[model samples]
Target: MMDVEVIENSNKCARCNYCRVCPIYTVEGWESASPRGKLYTIKSLVNGEIDVDARVVKELFKCTTCGSCEVICQVEIPLINLWENFRAHLNSKGYILPVHKKLREKTFREWNPYGESREKRADWFKDLKNLTSTNSDLLYFAGCTASYRTLSIARDTVELFNKTGLDFNYAGVDEYCCGSPFLRTGQRDLAQKLFLKNYKKWKEMGIRRIVTSCAGCYRTIAKDYPKIAEKLDYDFDFEVLHTVQILDEIVDEIDFEDVDVKATYHDPCHLGRHMGVYEEPRRVIEKMGIELIEMEKNRENAFCCGAGGGVKSQFKELALAIGELRVKEALNTNADYLISCCPFCKLHISQSLNNFDKNINVLDIVEVVIRTLNK
Candidate 1:
């Protein structure tokens, strides 16, 4: 018995185009870019209707894999999984994009998608209290983006834990890629290798729980990790959580001072649609006593930051183009700041904010905690 949701929906697709929800399609507007078109193309390929080519690979990889298409899909397709499955399928047929090929090599070689030195992974902690060990029950898995790219979020997250009297540990440089970048890009073989390595590390250290400020990390380790682990004949028993989920637990204990800006929250597609973590970040924001305005799309209906699915790395311009739309939605709220729980979202949307000449600040929930931590 196969998982029907996983196996049959692609063929069940009614070609209704109800899944016009694709972000890439929203920007590219090509029939090949839309989910409906992808399904047709995919169906044809499976039935020997067409030949695989560089062009098809390019269109298939155009997606952000945001799961929006999955939400509105008329046939209840497990669209995210479908896209990824097809991506892996494409890879099997030697359709690997150069960018994806480079990313896979860089991640495997450098232990991160950034191609940054593994030693510098802990550089963010040099200025702060760096906690790295498995002695503590909680391990802060900063993921590559937060640990290297968005250093402030990593620092501020530790600061928030301090302010709220939450005790945890950080993996620092010992942290490897969560394999999200590879997984999203259809490099499941590499993803599985990294996943097994990290799981073995946590198991050896007796880590009881893991928390992360990166939504991609949260989804990968919390949800995808266990799934992949079972495939590896390995079991990862540690509890996984997002920093916001931990903050939500200690939210009332921590004090917050309101700043001058009205803030709107952006839900990371991985955290919101991928994992269904809609309210914890919201609750953390509301508890700050700041004026929280809703974005045009919020919760389950939230738009993708265009940074997921390896889009930011491969299609930089397109990623920014899609991100600009989300930034526009945030700006329309007249909010001075755009807040999100995921560092990847922070990195992408923050770039868009600057690109649009909008003076709006992009903040992670941890930074907000640092601001109001009885200072």
Candidate 2:
């Protein structure tokens, strides 16, 4: 059974519809697309008031789980976790979405969410041996996307690490997905399995601290894993740090060449709101000596890239719509480039910009750092 407390607390939403004003659903303009609608549907299912149908299940899977609704809710409903629990319950009832099911299966078998071979996981570090040292206290956890699709980010991050004189080691194939995807999509059992595998590996390697570039991975490792660990009687005693946080700590030691580029940042929901890490990334950007332009909505109130909550895989159109809105917000700043700390945000926003034929450039903060270092 799902957590009783979560069910009780979530049911207190009272259908106030305060959360319907979120930019995501406002842009989509659908009632079933809103968080309250999904919550009521899930509550009905739990109360046996309505049978679980494919249409109802599809609505539940569409949400990015960005928690914008929870942020604005007067009743303080844990909508994100509540939706996740409902997804898990639906999966247990054999109602898995096809794409998500395939992704989960591949992640379970291949150790990466993309379902690719693990042998190529370390390909991003090719010819970059000088960038990392063998003995370093800092461990860079390059999530699957950066390792494969966004190899440039992985390369730039390592270059910045070397430029900053930070000792770093990366676990290549030995590293597995941090299980953020699984957790967000309601495959908690699989997420727990992945966490156990990763925690054991990190423990055996004597890793005292961890840093991640992916906001989802950062939140999962730093926040979710601890609770999972408690249930399994496993103690994970390590500092889970975001790369931006680490970069902020050493911002003073580095110097950047003057770059006259206007840039705006998109706050990845997991990193900015969920983890409360808004300042460090901004600090790093300012330290780079670039003009930091703020979107009308930023920090805790910033919009989501629409890639979270398994929406990218389940509802591609809606995810792209959310990403397009974010891209437009950055473009409104008239910034030459848009910067985000999360690789997933970078990927989604980049696609949206291309699709919309907008000229705004999308980049990771590490990419900006590496560029400034070279300049």
Candidate 3:
């Protein structure tokens, strides 16, 4: 978000209706929730046609910020950037969402968005002997979700790295937040502070390459961190690779046995569209010799898992609604395992599966590999 007005970007919306790919708009079917409608709202604000109000702010925050609209925009508007700017503007104008405000407070106090204690951040990997160390070729950054919620993914990923004989350091409790949550919520200033903290911590460890299991961390650290770094007067240029990318590189050494499960891969919005990493995760799945079922929406045109852009926390009903739609799509493929790369996506989609009373299992792509590794 720059010091300029949202009009600069909002004016670029051509109203071509190409942004119908937005999952929120697809389910809600409200023009105010569509990407095109949001841009018009911003323009209205700029032209003094409307004042900042809770209703307007609520409509703005309904967006998932999955970057789908920006991908298909006919006029090439920076819709993601514009939406973030609009949020920031609203925040400055005291039209902040109450849930987002509390989330910001929790992130600042707990150093994690879930309001969980930072002391237990690395408790996920405490059982692995000699797995946590420094002065290695790379640092395995177990993001907050992986470290706290998806413990198995973190453990399996570290085990996979060791099996492949990669020299990587694990930044356990010391690993600061990658600021993905805050950035998605337009708390860029707080995000920059975390960015500086993480960068300085990594610099002290002399870390060269960084690998993360979570897709949001991948997008935040790899894509947004650089821009945040420049804004905060910090200089850093280290390589950040998602675990899928690293696994794709070492696929030759890892032996995955055939599994009897029919799995459909869910493209996490940040990893696939935000980072352009559609092939690597799929390559890992294909190499395992399992049948890959195609979802009606996959890759760039893929539907969002409804977890991005703080929607999962604030708009619970809308989030679950979109996730259920995705789960129904996966169930349509008759896939036993609904595999996705990001832990957040797994969490949301898995919850939605419970609502449908379906027997589908939502597993991370890496988790799927870990199950079949050496079997």
Candidate 4:
């Protein structure tokens, strides 16, 4: 059965074409790839006007779910949630993509979508000094990407926290994936299991505040978890935050050496449009005395890094294409570095730059901040 809310929301597309601002639609150019086209297709499927086929499956899963369409939609439709719910519906009907199927299997079996060992989840920080025990008011969740794919982000974040004298804790091997991958890829059941696992662990540890270096984890825990908590009748008592929010609170207090550089900030979609975190990262960068340049599209209008919503894993070529466009925007500013708060964004944007013979440095804001302090 089709979701009633999905049906109602699909019926709400105004056909204003404002959602052409969608990054994927701009690249794919097929009307079927457009936000409106997806909505119409969804409505037809929901109303039994059409049947699911290969073309329908491909078009539906093509979106990165960046929430750009939601930002531009004149009818105020919540396109991001709509797409996820529609995908969930599809998943229930066994229409899961092959890569997404592997993603689900890995996440459920290994506690992360990357199929990485849970034991090595904390290996990124193994070499860092002054590690804390599992007990503290604060927890540093180095989501799957930072712990495995972007080791420097996790290390730099820990180093910054140590340098700044912030009392925090690390979950070590016990730190499960925050389930952003599951949520974005329509594995709500898997998401719930991970959420419950993390939530129970936090509660048992008496954790009052949680900080994550990854934007996807921050959004999943801060924004998505409470909804799950309410549904499951869990207490959900912890305060969740991204590292930039913590940096923003403390940036004014930190004294830094002079590091002259021109940089541009890329707002991760989970950090920016999905969660309204636009200025804190920029403010932190500017506070460091770096000349912060703005991209042609920024803040709520920032283009996606194309790594989210399972696109990079499932549709590699399309993801890189979208990512290349964002890298071009960063390069157009002629900046020395491209900065972002999300490790996933940093990882994808770095890979995207490899497509060009000329490349720029891509660092997480936390990495830049740590370097400035160490200098």
lDDT of each: 0.83, 0.85, 0.84, 0.88
Q: Model 1, stretches more than 4 Å misplaced?
A: 1-7, 129-134, 258-260
Q: What digit string (tens of lDDT, one per residue) describes model 1 on residues 102-176?
A: 888888788998899988888888777554333677888888888878888988877766656677776667789
lDDT-best of 1 and 3 = 3
**lDDT (10s digit) by residue, model 4, range 158-211:** 888877888888878878889887788788999999998888887777789999
What CA RMSD would you report for each candidate?
2.2, 1.5, 1.7, 1.2
The TM-scores of all predictions, comma-separated, are 0.95, 0.96, 0.96, 0.98
State which candidate has the highest lDDT: 4
By lDDT, highest first, what's the ranking? Answer: 4, 2, 3, 1
Off by over 4 Å in 2: none
Point out where model 3 deviates above 4 Å: 1-5, 129-134
Question: How does residue 263 of candidate 4 score in lDDT?
Answer: 98
Off by over 4 Å in 4: 130-134
lDDT of 3 by residue, 140-209 (tens): 9888888878888888887777666777887667788888877787787888889888888888888888
Better of 1 and 4 by lDDT: 4
Q: After superposition, how far is residue 48 of candidate 1 from its true place, in Å?
A: 1.7
Clashes of each: 0, 0, 0, 0
